[model samples]
Every structure is written in C-alpha cells, then in structure tokens.
Target chain A: MPRLSADQRHCVRLTLNGRAVEGEAEPRMLLTDFLRHVIGATGTHVGCEHGVCGACTIEIDGALARACLTLAVQADGTSVRTVEGLAPEPGRLSVLQAAFRRHHALQCGFCTPGILMSLDHYLRSHPLPTETDVREFLGGHLCRCTGYVPIIAAALDAAERLRNGETDA
Target chain B: MKPARFDYVRADSLAEVHDVLAAECGEAAVIAGGQSLVPLLSMRMARPKVVLDIMRIPELAGISLDGDTIRVGAAVRQAELLAWSQLKARQPLLALTLPWVGHAQTRARGTVCGSVALADPSAEIPLTLLALRGEVELSTKAGRRRVAAEDFFQGLMSTARADDELIEAIRFPCGRPGEGHAFREFARRHGDFAIVACAAVADGKGVRLAVGGVADRPVARTFAGLGGSMLGQALDAFAHELEAREDLHATAAYRRELVRQLGRQVIEEARRCRA
Candidate 1:
C-alpha cells in the first residue's frame, strides 16, 4: 500500500460504527476514500465526486454528507456510518435496502447505495415526510435509470411501513 | 478526481486561522463547509498549497442578533441559519431564498461564508445578501475590517477578501417596519444554480433591484422613486446595462430577458409585501 506522504498525513481519531478508530490520512484523501481504503468499509460508492450526485453520501455525526467531497481530516472526532455497517446480521438488509428491493426502487443499482444513505438520514429526521417533501429531500440523488417514480413510491412506502411498526427486512 | 495533496490545518480559533493565513501569505485557502472549495480543488480550478480548515473555528460559527442587525457567523451552515426563527422574521429575504439553496443534504454542510466568499454570481445567498445591503466583516492577523456587500463582490468567483484574512461574519441590516424585500429566480431544475435571479428591496421612496447569474457579478440599480411607465423605462435601461455570459445553462439573451422578467416580478412582489 502506498502510504500518504508524511506531509499529507493529518492525525485524526474518530468513532466508526461503535468502534474507536485512529489513523493518519492524506489531507487530500476524501472521506469516502478514507472509509473504503483505510477503514476497510467499501459500501460507500463514489459517483459524481462533486456534491451534485449523492452517490457518495454517508452519515457523519448524524447528518448526511457527500463523502466524495468531504476531506477525511474533516471527519476527525466524528462518528460515521457507511452502508456496509448499516445492518449487523448476515443475509439480511436494512429496512431502507429492503424497501428499495420491495418496491423496485432500483434498476441499474449504481445509485442505490447513495440513495439509501440519503433516505436513511431523511426518514430518521422526518419519519413521515409527505410525497412532496420526500421528492424534495431525495432531489440530490440522480438516478440515470428507473425514472424516479418507483424510488419516490418506495420512500413513501418505507415511511408508511416504518410508522406502522414494520421493521422487518 | 481527488484533490491535490496539501497540509490541512484545523484552526480552533479565529486568531489561529488569521495567523496561519498571515504565515502562509496567499498560499493558504480557508475551508468552511467545503461545499465550494472541495469541488474547486477536485477540478484543479483552485490549487491552494495550504488548507486552513476553519469550520472548527469557534468565532465564525452561529446566527445571532447584534444591535438591530442579524449577525451570521461565517461558518454557520445555511441549514442552521435557515432554522432560526428570528433570522426568518428579521431577514425574510434570507428565509425565502434558503429553500432554493442546494437540497437538504448540501445545505447541511454548505456555509454562509463559503457561499459569499466563493462569490458565484448564480448563488442565492450572495445576491440576496447584496440586495439587502449586507456587510462582511473580514479579519486578518494585522487587524479587522468591514466591507459592504456591494463592494465585497469583485467579479465572478471573486471577493474583496484578502489572502491573509478570513471572513469572520456577515451582518444583514435589520429592516425597518415598513421596508420589504423579495427574491425570485429561475433555474433549469430545482436546487440547481439559478440561471437568472433577482432580489429587490422596496422603501417608501423607491425600489432597488439586484439581478444575479445574468452577469459576471450581482448588479443593482435604483428605480429612483419611480413606478408605472417610468419604472418600466428604468427596468429596460437596467436590462441593457447587464453584461450576461452565454454558457451551457442559458444564452446571454435568454438570461437578459430572465433578468428583466425576474426584476420586474420581484419589484411587484416587494411592493405587495410592503403594502
């Protein structure tokens, strides 16, 4: 592995999914890269790299952020959750992931991880966002396929399910 | 693409950021929220050798009121500022334009100072701030200084912020009881950068019009206590003064028309808001 040069390393310590983690990351290394490469969580995908597409989204300190644009050093002392650690049990999906599958929310699946991350944060904050609100909240994620009609439905369905005490995935 | 390698220094204090900038001279760029800077760096558009991260800086973070002025710390995120009730009432211009900012996810991390400092002509807060006659407080290791929003924006992606200084805060002058402001914009898609935007402030005497994204910088002109036919003539003259750039988003002519339309609409809305 090619280590970040001495000058690029910023000593940072943070908690990742209930575990204390400390490392030196390049100032240039994106938070997505830090999570995937250094911390060994590869579920976070990088899609537009710019903040426009939400493919690289992650939850940092309980807020969704574009991991591709966020510097690793910026996450120092912060708690982060990647899609890989979203659920503990093997052969099972989180409610959102299962919802996406159940409602056919994804087609190509390239944009699913980011959509999942953004919707996770959105549903947590707004357990029951109206259709218009859900449309606006998920506006950042750009899905090249599926036309977003089903994705919108899935989000609404997931919200309804969650509010009705359905957590099984 | 990833950003070029640079040493990141997290400043715990405003003085520390200023000192670091002073030491690095023009080599350092302040990162507050990193919404604008991150893209600029990744695209290699801006290559500052030293990264002075100021999001952690204590002094540049929050929204407060000071002597009838709504003072917003530079590092205060747009979402946080929009959530304030007093900011909503005292600065309705900001509140109305807040939702148009990049969706909830982007607003969560984008800073007010980052938006103003980036000075993107199409951005919402800068033009609204300019129309509202906002003031930017800049601090350097040498001392502190203030610049009116009109003078602060130099041109496209430019501001009066010196290399050795950090934008400390922005002050929106509290509107008098009868004064009113209205902002309107047209974009290809919701939350996308505005193709053309207009912000208007109306007082008893006259209305002031400011248009963004139609020009390289936010341009303003006063109606000079005029309305009816005279107001229409002033708007036409102001539309001609616009220097619009033709980009993939909109043609210069289209943007100029947008400026004219939005300017006219905002003036009408401001009048109604006043009434």
Candidate 2:
C-alpha cells in the first residue's frame, strides 16, 4: 500500500459546541469520518456516504452542509455544531427535537439526529417556513421507514411552537 | 469506501498549482469544494496519482460584479452564488436555477467552476451558463484564455479545457433593462439529475433557448428578432433542431417532448418576466 502524505497536514481547531476541539487530518479525510471515528461523536450518522442522504448533516459556521460530502480540512478554523452540540444546554432535546418526538416524526431513528441539526440551523435564520417550505427544505433528506408525512408534520409543529412562544425547552 | 492511496498536495498559490500540474502531468487532479470530485475519488472512479487540493488558495474564491458582468471565482462555492444579493436582484433566473444544482449541503462545497469544468450535461451550471451567455477564464503555464460557454463545453463531461489548465473564473453578462430569463426542468425526484432542463433568455435581440440533460451537451437555439407567429415557429424549429440522446433516465422521444414542453414553458415565463 502506498502511504499517502500531505506536505502539511492542516491542523483544524474549532469550537465544537463551546468546547475547543483540535485535530490534524489529511486534506482528503471526510468530516463525517473525522467526527464519527476520530472524535467519537457518533451522534452524527452517516447514511448514503454520498450527498444524497442528509443523515450526515452538520452545521459549519452556522450553515448546514453534509458531513459525508465535505472534507475535514475544509472546516479548518470554522466552528462546527453537530447534533450533539445542538443540545448544549444539556439534559434534553432542543425544542425542535421535542416537537419531532411529540409529533412522532421518526421511527427507527436513524435519520433523526441529522434532521434535528439541519432543521435547528435552518429554523434559526428562517424561524418560520411554510408547509411547502418545509417540504421543499426537507427534500434533501431521504427516509425509508416513515415516509415523510410525520416528519413534515413535526417541522410544522415546531414552526408553530416556536412562533407562538409556547416553549423554548 | 476509502479513496485509493494517492499523494495529496494542498496548493497555497496558483504558481504552485501550475508547477504541481506540470510536474504530475496527466496523473494530477485539482479539488475545489470536493462536492463532485470527492465522491468520484471515494468511489475510486477517478484514481489520479496526485490530488491537488486547491481549496486553500485564497486567490480563487470570491463573487464580484464588474460594470456589466458577474464574475465568479473558480473556488466560489455554490452557496455563495445562491446567497449573493446582487445576483438575486439582478438575475432571478440564476436564483431560480441555483436550487436545482443540488441540495443546500452539497451546494455549500460545490464550486461554480467545478460544475462548469466537470461539464456534466445534466449539471445546472453549464446549462444555466449557456442560456446566460457565460464565459470561462482558464489558466495554464502558457497564459490565461477566456472561452465562451458554448465553446467551453464540447460533449458529456468533455470540455475544451486543457489537461494542464485551471479554470480561473466564470463571467456572465448581467441584467438587461428589458431582458428576462427562465429555467425549468423535470426530474424523477428532487435533487436528482434532470431528465430534461431548459434555460431561456429573451431580450431586444430576440429569444434564445438552451436545453440540457436531454442531449450529450447543452444545445442552444436563437430566433433573432422573432415575435408572434415567427416566435411560435422558431420554437418548433428549435425543438426539432435539438437531437437528444436516449438514456436510462428517459427515452430519446420522451426527452425531446420534455425539451419542447420545457422550452415552451420557459419561454412563456421569460415573456412574463419581460412584461
């Protein structure tokens, strides 16, 4: 096996949910692998490995991107917020996560983490996207178990809950 | 699957990139956002001996507007293009077609030049660039050359770009006072490659329609100064002129119909934009 080497392995140091995490990786290592294997943050799931599945979605500099499709070096010096980081206050799922649970948005729960993280970031800027917006926004994700009726409902429910000043936690 | 073992070089400058490409010759590959190239690498579909990482090159990432053209750097990510407020206001056609490129996540890493250089017939940038009359700036050890979008794409995943040349930037004429454009496509599912896509631009010069995904490369038809009856016939003639290739996505006949349907729809939408 030919050992691959980088002239300089870029050292990425960024805040992973208020905590500084640093690592040195080749420019080719996928951010998904860096998080799941290297950092042991398995909450960020990897589904299609390709960008087709949003299961590996994470927040980079407050914008959503598929972890599987992005190289770890690309996130250098940029803050990364994963599904684990979304609930940083701890002891509970975020409001969006709670709405998903209350609305029975997931089954088997394989894609839940990614959905939560993506929607969490999306809703932060959008705050209120219509039902059609939810459908179109969620088009990036694929769910085989529950179809998408419940998931869409969960997003709608969360949008309403967040809008109505019902509950932050 | 892990990509095959290969040497990696994170090029810090264009001079370094040129030297690396010259050194590795045919065995080198440049990566911008890795949205498209990374997948091919991981699948082992592209086994280049040297992967030239260009993401760190500060010279290659920005979106700017000159007097009348929008210049997008080679490394400018798709998200930047979509989010650009100037483009949104000046060119809604670009904004409309931007979403169809890929998912938000993929677009974050996908570069405008990468999409054009890859020149996937089904890719949105090439087709959109064709309709917008875009130009590509390519660089090599020899010098820099600009190629019009029509001349840039030769065939499926084929371009006039040289093996050792790097695409520097893509430029398209900005908004015209009375001109309007529209883009539409049909795919099996959202985020999937289009079965057929149409991008139409109309101005005082007349109507120009560009079609992609239904053919080996994007095909354009122009009806110089056509209107009313002449416009209708021109569209039919244009539809007849696009000789599409049949593939698993759709039969040749089916794709042809999509081209016609989408062409008509996009032309109508452009007319509305004009109004």
Q: What does fnat come to for each candidate?
A: 0.53, 0.38
Give a tens-digit lDDT track for model 2, residues B2-105: 66656777688898888877778778888887878878888988888888878778889898887788999988999889989788677777888999988776
The true-versus-predicted C-alpha distance at residue A5 of model 1, in Å, is: 7.9
Which pairs clash in model 2? none
Clashes of each: 0, 0
Give a tens-digit lDDT track for model 1, residues A39-75: 7877888888888888888888887788887888889
lDDT of 1 at A110: 80
Docking class of predicted structure 1: acceptable
DockQ of 2: 0.40
Please provide, for model 1 over B98-120, each residue's C-alpha lDDT reduced to its tens digit, 9 standing for 90 to 100: 88988888888888878999999
Provide chain B's TM-score, model 1.
0.97
> Any idea what lDDT model 1 has?
0.84
In order, the Cα lDDT scores of the candidates are 0.84, 0.82
Extract clashing residue pairs from model 1. none
